[model samples]
Target: MSRHPRLAAVAIATAALAVLAAGPVSAGEPTVSDPRIVAHFDFDAGQTPENIALEPDGSADLTFAFAHQVARVTRAGATTVLATLPAVANPQTPNIGAAITTGIARAHDGTLYVGYATGTAENGIWRIAPDGGAPEQIAQLPADAFPNGLALDERCGTLYTADSARGVVWRVPLDGDAPAVWATGAALRPTAALPFGANGLKIHDGAVWVSNTARGTLLRVPFAEDRTAGPIETRATGLEGVDDFAFTGHGDTVLAALNTPNKLELVRHDGTHKTVLTAADGLDNPTSVAVRAKTVHVPSAAYFDTTAPDPNLLLARISRNKL
Candidate 1:
């Protein structure tokens, strides 16, 4: 999902637009502290951790994209494979070009839901039990849909997914019903040059927030009382190559991962942002971010980095006052 040369082309085209959108909403510089590599994964083995879900005990569940595996990384730097999806015979998947596992969400009962983009019949959401066993396909999405970012709305008993190639948000009910399109608009679609659309998703404050990787913007879609989508709003822009993001537990503020730029930024409620971490802090194209209390969890897939690529989990302490 993260490209190097292609991303360079996108930067040339969108740089001026990003500067205009950036405006005067700068929140200063890096404020997060004590950033360190908590877990190291094998980059050559395709163990690129794409997304992360933090457990209550401080461990993290991740989707190893190219490896077709779901793993858990502990606070003490231990890694365990939780589930392995069936490998597709063909590697050249539609749109994004690989059969990989993208997003993951952990339910209250320890059920792990993940999005698999295989461009095949098994391209859907798979459920992994807490005890660990063969994963079950709970919802079958379209083969052409590249479901990337996933979020669980426990209150509504539903799961929301971002279709990176289709520019649509899909809603999957947990009651054995069917999955349906939740939202779609120009804002979620990708351009011809920039291939990825909706790259991240989250349910927060009675709304669903998503990042448009191609458009370099963050959008908010409110849920009506009946659980239908309200009007869409663009919360922030200029986040070129933004992948996945997490809230810092401070109202609507956010911590976003810039995939191509290899940086993490603290986005304020006023639409301004500032860099918090970079390659020097052990980020190799960070794909997603997760926050639990004061600890911040970030997984770098190293999808674009060619020289000295290191796919690992980087942890940092969230600044109580700065973030």
Candidate 2:
């Protein structure tokens, strides 16, 4: 999702700690009440945590392309490797150069859908059986078309992919069919397709909410029925390098990872937005955010030195009294 300008700059500087302190804290900043560090994983020894997917069983699956493996971190804090991806089919082509899995989602049937960008021309979708088998490529995307984000509409059995290169949203039917362009345009292409760009996505109610990193905007498009809608409705803007987001337990409140300042933001579905946490709140290069129960889990990745220590990705519990 490097298309966004703001995120491109952040990606260049992997020192997540430095970026978070670049700005000052203000009273208007999003309030993170009773924030505490619930869990911490040190990637300094080479466990680069990329994206996180939570299972119904309360286990957190952390994916890392550096290790070509997915680690299951149980709610009890024990970590285990769930699976390892195979080498790219072709190593010479830029499209299929390296097998870098970026996004992941689990279907209602327990099928795991993983999206990866082969350094070569071959980027596509893959499915891993619930019982755990080899990942099978389901669809091959176009050359230079990197699939960066994945969101599943379980009710409709539809999968959405954010094609950062083409600045388009793609829909793939779970029943196995050709993928179609669900949405496209310059507005969709917030930046060049870098971090925090169009990297976060989710389908809620009858619409798709996308985080526009370059413009620092969150966009909402009408559901499948309004696939041909003229333009997306701007839900919120002025955010700083907004990356991935997850809905709160109530589904109406959202917590977003702000990449630039390394903060977590809380956005109300009704259009109210606030910075809930800042550098003081202990987030570093907060790339993705997910909420389970009352806990907001954030994953901070250090992009510069793959060997540098990854920050203690915080899991803050939302105060029941505040909301």
Best by TM-score: 1
Off by over 4 Å in 1: 1-17, 20-30
> What tens digits encode model 1's per-residue C-alpha lDDT throughout 1-323?
33422234444444433641343433433357899998889887889899999998999999998888999899999999999998788744456556889899999999999999877878889999989999899998887888899999987799999998788999999999999999989999887777678889999998999999888788999999889989889988888678899998878889999887888977777777778799999998899999988889999988777677789999999866532
- State residue 114's C-alpha deviation in candidate 1, in Å: 0.5
What lDDT score is found at residue 323 in candidate 1? 27
lDDT, residue 272, candidate 2: 57
lDDT of 2 by residue, 1-323 (tens): 11211123555433322122223333333334666554566553335465678888767776664455666776666777777767766633222244566677887677888776664544677788888878787877776666767888787777888765566778888878877888876667744334334567787767777776666767787764545434688777666667778777555567888765667877766555667787677676676776676666777665432333454556666644332
lDDT of each: 0.85, 0.64
Error of 2 at 22 (Å): 17
lDDT of 2: 0.64
